[model samples]
Target: MAAKTKKAIVDVKKQFEKIAEQFQTFQILNEEGEVVNEAAMPDLTDDQLKELMRRMVYTRILDQRSISLNRQGRLGFYAPTAGQEASQIASHFALEKEDFVLPGYRDVPQLIWHGLPLYQAFLFSRGHFHGNQFPEDMNALSPQIIIGAQYVQTAGVALGIKKRGEKSVAITYTGDGGASQGDFYEGINFAGAFKAPAIFIVQNNRFAISTPVEKQSAARTIAQKAVAAGIPGIQVDGMDALAVYAAVREARERAVNGEGPTLIETLTFRYGPHTMAGDDPTRYRAKEEENEWEKKDPLVRFRKFLEAKGIWNEEEENKAIEQAKEDIKEAIKKADEYPKQKVTDLMNNMYETMPYNLQEQYEIYTEKESK
Candidate 1:
């Protein structure tokens, strides 16, 4: 008898690559500000479209002023938001007042729109206690600095919302690097298993500090990572505000409708270094590459789109820039009035009732402050 032909061996890596290819980056507007996907265009009113453009303009100015403050030693820690306005503000505009936001360090802009005081955000960068304090009515948490930890926390928050039968969703943001963390997988897995109303956003800005994302994962697309979690996943052009808003708005709708979680990957870029903490993008990123992304700037693209619709103009954009400048000036002044954070404040804030050991240390610091 002829030997049976061996079946073709499974090519796991190639199969995964094919799966990744299936997750196309969704786009409504192209790089030239032309509507490429007319069907995907959001049903936002003309006023809403103009407002989104205004906010994006404001955020660009905010990001510029923030970097200047960081260099002048007026701000403590800042992640430049220059190239991320569309990915940040537009997605934020899609949320309801009752939804919860668990943000990463780069997501202060979202928290601000979610009712966090601008002065408090300044204080947060300055390491002031009041900066971390959110108003009682605000449905948000202080931005998480421990990378992907917010993902796990968001899962818990969403689960709690589910248990309470509230029609609210919990959303979180983390960078491409954060997506590689063990907590990221655990959080998504837990949320998927429990059918929690959670939305996970991965801002794939191409780098995690100095490390390019390509070195972090073999997966071709970050959105495909959601497949393992058993949830819907999508990649959207982060440079298109309309696209981001539409995608997030739909995700929120599905979440509140009891459809469980969704993972969104925003294909974006950061114009400046990862942080104001001395790391420079110039070392690793090519100037040509930076210039290429500059041509697709979210602010520029959205501005053109709105201008074509006749709802936005350069004058209106300038007004938004001026308003952002004034607001930043006032916020920094307010932040200056906050008393400096103390070691004792850290100890006291850590627990509702201080542990005996911490209480002893708190007394020591208190005595020092008394002198």
Candidate 2:
């Protein structure tokens, strides 16, 4: 009887593996900008599609400007999301205003879509604490630069929402490399155990800075990691804005319905290096790989889709580009001229009353700086 039970378990595991392999990367748009999966396409109005396209274009322009700013020594460091716009924009768009967002370092597009002022982002890049402050009504957290740290906080937020019986969901963004962190598992496990309304979006951009995905984890897909935590997982083509929107919409629906958390693995790529000041990818990754990804560039493909729908043209494209450039320039100007942060503001906020030691230290630092 024991031998029969063990064999049954092995057979079931093999069957599950076979079934999983059949789930291909979910995609709605083809490389030629055609909607191959028409069933999965959302019913977006012409104006809505055009607006999304404009945001994507703006995101690309922002990335370029950020890199230039870094090179010119205006900004400290920036993570460029050159190739992953669709995944970030689409996922954020699927959320309601009440839903919460926990973003990773490279998710600037998400923050922008969530109504974070561009000037604040610029200020943050310049190392200002005020840039981290979200509007009182905005249900978004500040961008977490420490890789996968946001996952744990997002889970806690979800738990609080569930406890309060609120319909809000928490969406946590992470990269493929972040999936390898222990906190990722811990967060997901807790979310599952508590049935917290959290959705983990992993942007699998093939490479994590210098390391490839294969070296990062042995799992075939980051989505598979959801299985151990007893949650649903889906892999979608991150380049297909419609597909990402659909997947996230479904996950958000499930979360609100108290169906527990879901993990979404967005198969995307980053055209640039890990950060503005990083080495060229041509050294670690082949030029061919970069060229191939360029062929499936999310912005390029989405533009084609919009054109097919008769909502975009060269004139509008050029106009949008110019407008984005002007807007970014103005933001930079404003951020550059903003008043400098007071040194004491940092140590004074967290405590009701300043501890004696910290107060003494703050005074000493201020006195020396004054001299």
TM-score winner among the candidates? 1
TM-score of each: 0.95, 0.93
Looking at model 1, report the run of 10 residues with the lowest lDDT sum: 343-352
Inter-residue clash pairs, candidate 2:
none
Q: What is the lDDT of residue 361 in candidate 2?
A: 85
TM-score of 2: 0.93
lDDT tens readout by residue for model 1, 1-371: 99999876998878876896889999999998999999988899998888888888888888899999999999999999889989999999999999999999999999998998899999999888899889999999988999899999999999999999999999999999999999999999999999999999999999999889999998889899899999999999998998999999999999999999999999999999999999879999999999999999998898888888888887998899899999999999988887888898887787889888778888888999888
lDDT of 1: 0.92
Expressed as tens digits, the lDDT of each residue in 29-118 for candidate 2 is: 988899899888887788878888888888898899899899999988699898898899888888998999999988867887787888
Compared with the true structure, the alpha-carbon lDDT of candidate 2 equals 0.88
